[model samples]
Target: MATTSFGAMRGLLNVKFFQTNFSAMEHRSDIKKDNKMKEFQRILKSLYENLIMLELYPRSQIDLQVFVLESDGSYKSAAFNAVSLALMNAGIAMKDYLVATTSGLINNVAVLDLIYTEEKKQNCEFVMACFSQSKNIAYLSLNCNKINAKDFKNLVEMSQGSCDQISQ
Candidate 1:
């Protein structure tokens, strides 16, 4: 995954995996404002271990390169959708389709796939990636300001309705 920032314009992006032998993740944020690299690594590990059928191939690496072009909203979610399709297109085996979305718990109401402006106005951000068939979370990331951790699960579930759309 990656993000670019120049003066005021900012973007977020990512790549994904398929059934392969080697796995590596790289993310660069020139602006150094948000540490998305850390989140990227976590997602990478989950994808590699949970979805990819690594046992099929040995001593090979499937170098997936993630790049950020332009983004005004939840690019990570878009990236996941793109990567999953790429993996499918490449004939890589996966357990299921992975769908993702970014939303916000604003004014006690959970919102769906939020844009940058809407995301910023809220006190928290929710990022989620899951299996379309299982509804199991393959990856989850959150950015919060003055919010309760206990409420995170419910908030995430509330936004699941949005993620379901992309999974299809």
Candidate 2:
């Protein structure tokens, strides 16, 4: 994905075919198909829509699958990065590189690229996925345990910074 580390987190990315039931003459199934995809699978569709030249392959189907070989924490971030690379390896067109990272606020202390143990101890958790060049978030998921407003703000900033660092 973004980085290879001795860190326990591990990820895998795979691509599969897209399936939809619409008349070839209609050519309007993409919208409907998206509505039916699972949240995780739908994420791949979003990335394809945002970055790929889908018009180049009209009526074509492309699907992506991501697996966590192992995990310590930040699995979502790793999965995003892995899929980006898989797209590149397939010679697919792209707007830019995609990268991601995770952060957690534990004991009022902010930590970057959290490990599983650290995540288990956190007051809040944050994850972000964004384009490296555009720096626009494709996805963000945050969970808090009664975290204060100020701390929540700081966590967002910290997560953004971590996401940027991975992109670089």
Best by lDDT: 2
As a whole number from 0 to 100, the lDDT of residue 31 in candidate 1 is 44
**Candidate 1 C-alpha error for residue 155, in Å:** 2.4
* lDDT over C-alpha atoms for residue 12 of model 2: 22
What lDDT, from 0 to 1, does candidate 1 have?
Answer: 0.64
The TM-scores, one per candidate, come to: 0.70, 0.69
TM-score of 2: 0.69
In the range 28-136, model 1's lDDT, one tens digit per residue, is: 3434423454457457655744575544434435546655555566777777877778778987666687888887777766777787677767777888988888888
Alpha-carbon shift of residue 23 in model 2 (angstroms): 40
Question: What TM-score quantifies how close candidate 1 is to the native fold?
Answer: 0.70
What digit string (tens of lDDT, one per residue) describes model 2 on residues 36-111?
3356566665565667654444435556766544566676677778878888899877778778888878889878
